[model samples]
Target: MKKRALLIIAGLFLLTSFPVTGGSAKVTQPPSQKEEIIYHIFQRSFFDSDGDGHGDLIGIRQKLDYLQQLGVTAILLTPLYESVYYHNYFATDFYKIDPRYGTMQDYLRLIKELHRRGMKFYMDMETQYVASDHIWFRDSYKNPQSRYSDYIIYTDKENTKPLQIVAGISDFKGYDGVTRKLVMVNLDNKEVQAYNYQLFKFWMDPNHDGKFDDGVDGFRLDHMMDNLDNLNRLPHLFTTFWNPLLGKLRNINPKIKIVAEQANWASFGMDYLKDTKIDRVFAFRLAFAIRNFNKAELIKVVDSTLIQTPKGKQQIVFIENHDMPRFSDAVKADPGKLKVGCALNLLIGGIPSIYYGQELGMQGSRQNFGITDANDIPDRQAFEWYKSDTGRGMAYWYKNGPWWQHNNNDVPNDGISLEEEQNNPQSLWNFYRTMIRLRKNNPVLIGGAYKNLINNNDHVFSFLRYEWGKKVLVAVNLSGDKQDVVIAMQSAKQIKNLYGIQPVISENNLAVSLPAYGVAVWAVK
Candidate 1:
């Protein structure tokens, strides 16, 4: 509150002609509406501290200072439960931490360190399916009289054949080169729902002392859907299964936030917001639109996304994620397009998420390796921490394997590693840092409402973010050439450049010039 006057005064009298702001007016937004900048890390691909090639919890703790300096408010990690798979998605033991990732003490220490620095930890939880070795499946696979028989979905009346998971199959080869059996859980059963609630609650308050210092702040629900991949087995899940379980978890920790990944990427996820009332959802359509670099597409997607979002909820915007292709490969490693992507990722009206290696412009695309989950390994490669692959903390857990043959993404001396770009001022790493800092310093950019602008040129994508009396305008050129566009003001008569090249006023119109793939932010007067 004390710095509000100085900030407002600094924003005014900014080398332009506009009405002066005075009197007792002030700007503020609701606490719930304030968004978070999250850094999404693949647990096994982040960094390794024990020389085990696989990334561990201790590695993440060691890098907390680096992450804190990057200005992200939170970190979202993939599932950490014990599993036989490389990605650790299918849990063999739901209650134990994966040995490859470290021990329970390591996980607890990571949470404590994260909370100690005011950073939240959002654990990725997927309780829908388990591997063949899970206790529920092992005991009840062919034994109908077992007490846990109803815990898993069985095909025949005798409980001999279990229903398949996502791909409608009983088995899938894991990254460990083992074709392990899999089974979908009977989510409709009340017992299964109760188990899920308990699992979620355990992560929220591990020690259960009423203090969450050792627990996660929230959960990232993976592959959350109503019908479980539209297999029609668990119908009306949002109303019958999810709502009841989520309500109980919220009751325990009222401040806890849950982020759901809507199974259908093409969907606007309005139902997830309106029905389940989740805190945030991934903006998949906008991520596709950003990669296309089409101004009309960007305008339409951004407008449609914001309109569909219910009040008090937000959309998480990003160019790529664990399942998506790296943005560097999508743009052919073009620096300008990368900068434009960074600007929109942070400045858009939503909570922003940055994939682990995205800041360094690392490249990887999903490959079709015929069979198995090896195809997605390129998208989840080890974080490039040095100019060369052989480094102390390099978490190349998939190296010296058949899958590594296809991963030409991590070429040496390619200027993609953090070590290569850490000192370069014009690198993508610096651009991301600058954009994050700008978004943090400006309150309007965090909680302001988005309004698309109608510029003259089709290559220019412009929007206005306004809260209370403060307004900020962002314009990005999506083309490969220079562009000039005029923004007609309805109320404010002038615009002052705050983050990029300055613009001039021509008969009440704010005409701005931009370089190829240039982005600028202005303080509207």
Candidate 2:
């Protein structure tokens, strides 16, 4: 069945290619801002340089030009630490970079290259858990006399069974059905806290120099929640762990941004921001609302998030990430829907993050709901660089893996490879590139205050972005039918179309006919 699926998918890709257009648009240098456009990259699947079929720091360094061209001011990489799993979320060594990624020197060179190109780097860090092979866990598992015995949360004094917060949980298994024993760290342990702090500091400034040229600009704290294990194991994590750790890091580098992936996606991350003082939090609700095309819910979520979030704190809005299926896949690979998603993702008021290959309209989804190592392999497939399955930069390291064999339907010729899209102005990739350029060029769209516009039509979601005498009106048609809607924006001296058809403005009312999945953005004076 899987082989048949792969053949069908390949046949779909082999369809007549869209005629390539000549000439690419040149984008200007974006204005400097505290918040930036970030590109989230799964390093293992991004670009491989050593022909090892795995992406490395050197490969990322070589692609700095590509990132710069994409207008991403920063890049957020998944964990680079040694791990037993392919994702590297569970750390085996706190101090060492995964040999699959590169050595510490290679990391330093990548950081230096990013800095040279005026781009910042942020690494994902999940310090709550460690693989069974991790030295701390290995030493603490059976021996009570071991120095690291108190580092993890064990059910008993003898430390026989690691604390199972939820009974009979088997969600942490790897792709190969191998049960991954990831013991949660006891953050209350002072020694454990100290070790984590040092590990964070080492990555921030590896050389101990006051000049942080070779250091990371920030970290994305993964699975961060006030209560761990859902058993109230670590209830005061924010006060006891995050606050002090963030304080010390800010003392070391005030510009460092620490973003949290709130454990509970349903709730707004305001508590994490206000109490813990983290710089940013993922807007998971907004992301889901957008993905489902719930315009009413999306507007309400955006309004509440913007209105309720405290000052000086930012939200990182994204349609897809490492954990979820690609936006293109979610939207069934419709180019129109992809374009609509791109407009909302880039133009909406927040720090937008583009998942790698999102611009190319990549399609993939987890194959199984059961805890298996191969589940996420579909979502983490190699980036489609060219319009061919086999290409120069394709990272097909997982070709022989069970996950790849089971779910390898997504190929370069899916009509959305970067090479194919780069030459077509109407491609999703160009739409994203153009929208990003527009966002970077317009300060009002970047950091402006968001106001949900009153519109009678449910499918037409309109909003106003205004800041200090600059205002922009944005409306997106979420449905697949032409809709005529009247917006309540009166004071419009000049109007400029950013996407879709231009609007018709009259006294105190703005009317526009939007095609199915049409988007319109206007700079209103």
Tens-place lDDT digits, model 2, residues 460-487: 8887776656767898998989988877
On the 0 to 100 scale, the lDDT of residue 384 in model 1 is 86
279 Cα displacement, candidate 2 (Å)? 1.0
- Candidate 2, residue 439: Cα displacement in angstroms equals 0.9
Which residue pairs of candidate 1 clash?
none
- Minimum summed lDDT over a 10-residue window in model 2 is located at 16-25
> What are the models' TM-scores?
0.93, 0.91
After superposing candidate 2 on the true structure, give the runs of residues whose Cα lies further than 4 Å from its correct spot: 1-35, 165-172, 406-412
Clashing pairs in 2: 174-372, 174-373, 175-373, 175-374
Alpha-carbon shift of residue 250 in model 2 (angstroms):
1.0
